[model samples]
Target: MGERRDTQLDALRAVAVSLVLYAHFLAPGGTSFLGHLGVRLFFVLSGFLITRLLLEARDAAAFEAGPALRSFYVRRAIRIFPPYFAVLGLVWFTDLEQSRSSLTWHALYLSNFWYALRNDWTPWVLCHLWSLSIEEQFYVAWPVIMLLAPRKRIEAITIGAIAFSLAYRFYWPITAVPALARDLLPPASMDALACGGLLAVRRARGADVPRWMRRGWPAFAAAFLAVVWS
Candidate 1:
């Protein structure tokens, strides 16, 4: 089951990356809807995979908060920081004029917030790091919640997060909130991640796939069409 799921996820990742590359190279002005969809797909996929890993760790014997958190942080740092700093260093050395003042924000994983407030000042190459910052921020909060919350309440929490994210995005105009608050922040984007986490929880609990979704190619066709239309 795990192998099959991993294969499916790899396929999805390939599709998402392909869409992003296509948008960058083929689409006019690099503003294609496909590019946005690709990023959303990545966000959902990341949430699902990370939650599944944490769930597995929780199920293992001798799980403890301190050790689990330390391991998680160490693993994340090793996996993420090396390549990230390398790229940042290259950008800093080659494009000092554009990256000098804003390098601190990237280093501190607050590039998203910085860009939100000063959209016009963002260097194009580092603009993409905004999503990475959001993911890092989510990682900080999710493990603690998962460790402390009752298993029965996990789904409820995920659903509540999704609802809160939707409300934050939708209510911004009505409340006259600044665009910066709603656009690049983690809260406004939690819905997609929470949706993925919810699915992971349901699957882990052995919930059956819905009849409509289990109908095979027809269901797949409908989903594909919906995505294309969107």
Candidate 2:
């Protein structure tokens, strides 16, 4: 049977997917609030789940960095690679207009950076891959950090990353940098993931969340409405 916690996560995932679908199909115009909220929810959930798994592995009695890292990578590869490559193959075979060079970016999981550099979206077939690239990039760096960082310091590191992401997003446009750099790149959006990681770590440590905070659904609902109506 699946863990009880997974039931809550599955419900959250359903809600996130619904919001994304609603934003895409029903909402008018660019960057709908629901879409952004859904994407953020996905990021947070990804961070939480990945961090929790890594922590569990580290705490295992037979933990060895080499074997553990290899195992993690293998599992991720098995889970993510086949379908991803199949889609890329299909796109390549069918889309004569797509630049051969652009395929390199997608293959390397750097489609987000490629689009950001050009300040244009990839063809519809690949435009949505940017978020996948961001997550893949995160997967590359996060595991190493989690494996090496001291337990007490991990929370601070995650917090610092979140702060940096927020600052980068807020300030990037003001600078002479490219607009898409902040808009599409992982650095400017890492805060959502970091927030999730922070929560996971705290929960793993058995930190007591206040009852008021635990029951703050009204606040979230109000915020959601504010975004939707804004």
Provide TM-scores for the models. 0.85, 0.87
Among these predicted structures, which one has the highest lDDT? 2
Q: Give the per-residue lDDT of model 2 (tens digit) for 100-145.
A: 6588899999988998888877565687788899999999999888
lDDT of each: 0.78, 0.81
Quote the positional error of residue 44 for candidate 1 in Å. Answer: 0.6
Evaluate candidate 2 by giving its C-alpha RMSD to the native, one decimal: 3.3
lDDT of 1 by residue, 93-197 (tens): 998557877889999898888877774435867887888899999989998887778989999999899889877777765764345556578886787788789
Candidate 1 — worst ten consecutive residues by lDDT sum? Answer: 221-230
Off by over 4 Å in 1: 1-5, 175-181, 210-230
TM-score, cand. 1: 0.85
